[model samples]
Target: MTRSEATPLTIAYTATSAEPGVNIAALTDALTHHANSALFPGDGEVTLVVQGRAPVTFDLTPMRGDQIEADMHKKAEQINDQLNHMLAEVAAHSEILEASTNGLDVLGVYDQAIAATPQGGEIVMVTSGLSTTDPVDLDAAGDWQLNPSGFVAQINPRDIPDAQGRSITWTGLGQTSTSHAAGTTDPTSTRARPNSQQANKKLHTQHAPGPAARQALHDLWLNLCETSGASSCTIDDSLLPATPTTATNRVPVIEFDQVTTNCLGTFTLAADIAFSPNSADLTQAADKLLAPIADALATCPDGRRINAYGHTAEVPGSGDGIGLSTARATNVLARLQQLGAPRNTIGIPTGYGDTRPTVDNTPNGAYREDLARLNRTVELTITN
Candidate 1:
């Protein structure tokens, strides 16, 4: 599953009080920090509403006397104290419970409690990240010059006090790299969840690239050879399909009938490479397939624009709605941008959902693969 829809991550909260000094906004910020700061944390989302009076909550309890501020300095300890306790309580009964909190009320009595909790789910605090107006860059590009200097990633979650009457504490780790390598302050030092390590490990397991991606790679290799002055090249087994779903799929490789080389020029090309699983991420084979294009762009005059549009078969319950084709197109565009393609020169991606099918949607065994192949094509157009 994509990180957004992954399990073990959820946030449901509402503020009981709506007082200004209590700074529901500030408390929200603190709680967001708590959620993101956890070790081996899953992707989290939060929704909050304010009720009659704001309620303070936390994991660990803070000292008896302390002042509350938006910065969450002294008060953070109190909130963290309460939050820890609440997490334990909720985890014990309802594995998951929607948590929330209010801060700086001057009342020492039991302040925080969890309600409407989910059964058999882990209890995790939720909050938002700091807000900033900065340009952010995605790191899939081989070279980094394509991105702007300043980029932003934001997190903001609501604050909640724990079961123990104290406010929760959270630490915001600012300035993380998209690569996710440990920043200046090492991530190992921070406390993490029990499943965090195992979870990350499972996430990294390898899988083979999907068929459309492999075919696109093969086509790119042949395209490059024909364009370049090469004596001869062989299509390796790695580039061919291991199993054939149809007659065409069984072909060893989409090898050129005859190699041709004459004139060399640079042109731009774009396509929406496909994958098996429901994800936009490109596999290594996909990258290899596109490498020739990148190489041509960098060196050959005929280097194409390489729009990198995405496409998918029209399937039921796939949310293949109106804008979905457009989304697939944009996803392709983004990949090209990330690959260091000249940003200004490339055209915006456009999708043709089953609109311009190369074959009938109806299945007819071997023939069905041809139509699907044609529909799944990443149409490449060359221009000066």
Candidate 2:
């Protein structure tokens, strides 16, 4: 299959002293997984925003891909190299300014990144999700109660541009760290103590938020992204595991028909192959159709739930239509779990049956096969 051109990508990253510092190595791993995930298009421009004392931007020219290759080999490598150099700069500067954090700088960076891409694009923010500076101080006492709606309301409208239907992803929230310098451990021997004790004391400290706090942060960002008119918002607080270099440039495996601003993803499967005739058993072709849906569900961040609803056409003589529909919904849920979707994130499956059809099954006393086909579907909605 011929591939279409990829949309441009913008990444905004910050590691400040107010919260735990970001692990550069882990970030590298995440970026590699992201780039290889095929979510980014080839021959697309890349914009990097590093938030330090201020927001610093780096806009790389588009890197064209080879037409003969199925994946973005040349483009991914070039983008990775360019981004790595920029991330190195962020790391070096972060070390120098470890005592202070300008968390508010991310708003300006978001504005700049969004304004730069008027047509549309994807924007990724990697930060602790805690802002210590003015405008919005998440770290301040009594601010923990701030919800997404309240947070967005307090922000200056002029500071953040409308997302214009762009995709926004916020990750690495609440991942904080600390580091201590080497110190003495011996009561005597004033010569700076033993090397072994000193070395162990200088370890890096990593801290993750409790489940409640993590959920609050996720909700705040998810709300902000949606309020900004983003087409979709994906917030995953967990640190991405290290992936092998061999997996760095693979094609994206998941695609959806549409993902609303509310993060509701709808996938209309092919009715002919969705299930066996008059039975709950899914056909082999249904596996291919549902695979991407499972992948999409897996990306949902914590504190959110996935609710799947099954709908079927109106079969006049079909006995137990509701039972069949419910059974199909249950099977779909089970298949999704088998396909790697988190069981905790999925809610109980629901069957709408023929009670709610997308189109008229028998318009003017004539059965419409096309209309009925459109009604056979499973809708997945994500909510906080």
Candidate 3:
């Protein structure tokens, strides 16, 4: 969700025993390696609470980054610069002075950076990319001046661990221009899980997709140009899964109405199941919206199957929309199952995070959250 209940962005972590030295350079690489995750377009200092050391806060106010890779680098640079300066000051002046420079507030909060400290305090950085500070425009994050002397995309997931004892992996949901290219490493490379990451892993355990579910899902499609309440509908059937015969469904055919192109990517849900930005949990109102589809799946013929498609608006610090989207589709799929849709009939959960945006999310382009809501929808289709 855009606004969390509480807890803000504080992430509590537990590491087993002591390991190697604190890898700040690796940390910087992991945090800014990709445009996705651990940062929100929000405001505030990035408060990193190591196991035992004083809590370290990186003020992100004057520092501006819509959570983009480049901007994150800028922010990371700010952090690195401040830490170095503080450490240098502590070495020269004897004790680091409490201060705020380049939008960082570590001295006053963490006491002061000494020449060295006791070890064993591992790290876990957390961010909704959000903050109490003024909102940021993700589109504009890239426009900042770059430090030509140092802007490298060399850090791989190996540098960071995903806390789950696994790597930073991306289950493909049609990703484009993604960092997921055939890697120098595997999908299971070390990556940070933080708090939200733990929840993401649980979603995949719900159900395992098989040939039966995959085949049945082909029946669902948004091929209706005359869908109800559509503003402008022009969808390429080739781009979508094949449309199954609607005659078998007990409920009225679910048609789609296309919103303006600026709203989001090409595919909009005909049913309009609204999911908040970055949220996987469904609401009671969402249950109402999905009731019909579930009802249809309940009475389907043997081997009948349906598919749930999830989408997210392309936004900065949006993390791997894949996990978020997959979590969403799984949540909706679970509801459909609860409503009597058979497990086999439920195809795989697919999430199309910001990678596939119909609308341009450039600076000032995604100003309105309502407009982005269309992208955060789950559409249903019959496979067989």
Candidate 4:
């Protein structure tokens, strides 16, 4: 019923299915679900990544729990706080996945095991899985060892998965400034964020952040998870300048426009939209469709403004596709404010009914669902 302090680990996430715009609350929920469902004997970290967006990570340190009242008085409260904080962040990640992810496919989940420095010796993989009988004990045949040379004579390093069930495939092997490959160096002393996304599927990675950037992002995640609608909230200690600058502290919002790392444009939604019976009335479940739009708002709050555009192709349906498209646009816009988008930032809804089609929608005995679906998307564009 107790855990050792040496089992500290970090869990990070990257969301590629949805656009960068997202509410921290959604990420918090997703991460919470992931952590709760995850099998861990001790504490760890959690993160969220969106395509073309800045990543968010949370470090949940381990806490020792004892039945003794005195022990509970000192560690339980703080430990509870840490757990609650992690749950919030994790839940946010789950929200994006469940609601807006296009294909339910993720880049990867990067996990780095943290071990107590040996008594001046090389570090080895630290986990309970080394023992055939007891997978959670570190005193196994080859556990509690950090092979500085990245060579494990007793076990095939390729076969070993981290605390989470993530493996390090050949494609995932690399030492970059952003992420560190497993066992390449003692993680206790080094900080690396290797490419954990979609690298052969055996393992995942995270963006390596410097000490300051890590701290800054950590604070941003906490503020986003803790405060409700923190549009005007500020953190850290920096005065508002006479003129505006990036350094000014305000509630963190999505900046998809300037996150040039991805430089995404005209992002498209998935094909799971739920329209009411022959009408553009978004069903109750259709609320999920707005999640990505909300994410865009949060991801690029200060970048360039956007217009929520709805489109439809001329097809055989009960109602006029143009009217349906217009209805979809209006409904989507009505929910934008609720999603945390700044009022002046998101433009009014516009519908392009077959007027603008990604593919030729001409009535030449050639109307396909795939082409029509592309035209039926609820997309975002920079305001003119």
Candidate 5:
């Protein structure tokens, strides 16, 4: 089961008040199963770190099974026992510390783990992901709407020390929980069946986030791991499925249209590339948004003509929609050429303005800004 005898493993965890959704028992069981499997190398050293206002670290016994499967099983059992005890200690300490206003710092712990581990070592994070610390405060209101790409763009990779070539795993993200006073059992528990009046009474609760928020939380971590240059990234969301089920609010960066005769390909750029009001200048984020499209266009067969068409929303007060749209298309094509799309293959940029909106500008005599946003887009078409 050993890939290399030198690689180490680090398990970093945080237990906060909002941790009912994370089943520590289940995680322990999963870890125990993995300890006996090929996933954990017999020679790898393991460490456990509990993240709080100040992180605590524990060095666990290494696996010394030699070539005997029976010896490996014995060592695995010892490791499992040690891990369980460490997790219980973390939980007890967190319960006592929950009264403090400062919550657990997940990113800080991650940075520490990444710095400590070698290049091929794995770092497993067990967290509720509701960090209240700097760098990234997942508990903030604005963070709930953060998209993966946008959120990753905000982070400077240099801040994470020794991040390259590491493997990362995250569990129990976006899960929140509530609890009642001591001696009060959970009303929903099967062991207790209180009267109707007792059941109807309200208890202090931390409402779980909706599907969209959960998805955003998951995507944020996934993107962060990718940006950190992890050799592999895995999510062990035992309570919830690892894959997010709900659709996100943001539109896809680019959507390709069906190929037709005389047209090599066509794609629409909508919410992916944002622009300021009545402005054609590309934002700082435009490069990241357009890089993939430019890379794809660069791979196209030679001699194909590339054209860009820009459209505008039909707002009455918006001045010179045609002129603005033309400038926007021209800027996009220029940027594409700069990003390695063939400059010689570029065709004239055109402005359809408010003439070819994908959606209705007004519905039931009311203007819808959301629909108008869809109308304001640029389409890139490649032809024979």
Candidate 6:
């Protein structure tokens, strides 16, 4: 059968329960298994529309609370590890076909889609799902759709059990920039050294992408995916440069002692941002959590440009929480602007969502606030 005839070029994932908690890794894996078992059968164009609650949290700890920050950060690392593992697995397994992402990043989903799609196949569109659906027809002919029954949307992390399904919400889902939000306008500007440990590990990596090198890196991923057939792609977050500078070339790595990387000091979880039963709006308390971020940026040297890096918990079809990731990104950036950050200086908040996690989401029952918290941070690479 021709590629089109083998299966419905488009397949949608509807979560049985809207409030499935923040354990998106589990949900995504379950959905992938279901899709693999049901839709694709063997291998076909995999396009899933995952409609469910937003699984993520954006709570910052109080001041003078290193222990809370340290613990939360550690949890974040663990969650990231899980996400990365899942990405590698997906890259390894699914023959992606022509796929589109609602929250995954260029690096996270592009390679997988490229590997799955044959030459002359359509270019995958990685975007947001505010509600219904975003078009994903490369041929510009197929009309696709994704309808969320009663999914909750949030911008924070923490499972709140209620008459509604248990869910982790990000109080800042459509708020403002947190870390580095890069795109065409605010492309991967530079490969500068980091100002802090996290920044150092991410921004100063030798193999990090530069202007001339980024395209090649992107193309390499695309080519790898095109030929990968059914292989997963995973990259160590440590390898990524922390402070992404804006330049036409690669910048040298900045050491930890050079600048005060403690721009945001610590993230204290005041009250986990809770979403209404099933929408992506931030609660009053959740909105308060992001106000200090603007203050954090204001304390930066020039305070003009700050990186808004997006993350997620998990969602069905498109990894654990990539959809949540992008939504959080958009939310964070919006919040920052609302809190008074200049619009132009603020880069586009990009979401890698649940495609890359720092922990594993397998085995038996693994659902909790801490685990979800691991996937609910927005890194900021303060720029001069």
Cα error of candidate 4 at position 366, Å = 4.0
**Residue 338 lDDT in model 4?**
73
Ordering by lDDT: 5, 2, 4, 3, 6, 1
TM-score of 2: 0.44
Q: Per-residue alpha-carbon lDDT of model 2 for 1-384, expressed as tens digits?
A: 233434657666554432334444555654554444443334334455655333345433223453322446675666577667767775676543232232334455566667655445678777666554445455442333323455567777665569976888787666553332112233444444222234344322224443334444665667677777888888643454322110000111111222212234333443456788667888997776567657766776776666667777886676436777788778877887899888886777788888886556767777666456656666555566
Residue 78 lDDT (model 3): 61
The number of clashing residue pairs in each candidate reads: 72, 3, 21, 45, 0, 79
Write one digit per residue (lDDT tens) for candidate 1, span 36-144: 4432222222322122123323323233334223344644654555555554554453312211222211111111112322222222222111111111111121211
lDDT of 3 by residue, 274-371 (tens): 45435686766565545655665676677766666776666666564777777887887788799876788778878877666543444355344533
C-alpha TM-score for every candidate: 0.28, 0.44, 0.31, 0.30, 0.47, 0.28
Off by over 4 Å in 2: 1-5, 19-44, 52-104, 116-118, 141-148, 180-208, 240-384
Among the numbered candidates, top TM-score falls to 5
lDDT of 6 by residue, 124-145 (tens): 2222111122121111211111
- Which lDDT tens digits does candidate 4 get at residues 1-384? 333322222222222211121224433433343334322433334433332234445644334442222343544454457667765654654543221221211112211111121111111111101111222111232211211111122334343333222211111111111222321233353433122222233322222322212222323222321221211222211111111011101111111111111112343332234455446666665455455545556666365566656677657653446666777777766676677666665676777776776444434666666345445655544442
Listed per candidate, the RMSD to the true structure in angstroms reads 24.4, 16.3, 22.4, 22.6, 17.2, 22.1
Whole-model alpha-carbon lDDT for candidate 3? 0.34
Error of 1 at 368 (Å): 5.7
Model 4: CA > 4 A from native: 1-265, 270-274, 283-289, 295-304, 316-320, 361-363, 382-384
**lDDT (CA) per prediction:** 0.31, 0.54, 0.34, 0.35, 0.57, 0.32
Error of 6 at 210 (Å): 37
> For candidate 6, what is the lDDT?
0.32
Q: What value of lDDT does candidate 5 attain over all alpha carbons?
A: 0.57
- The parts of candidate 6 lying over 4 Å away from their true place are 1-279, 315-320, 364-370
Q: Of the candidates shown, which would achieve the greatest lDDT relative to the real structure?
A: 5
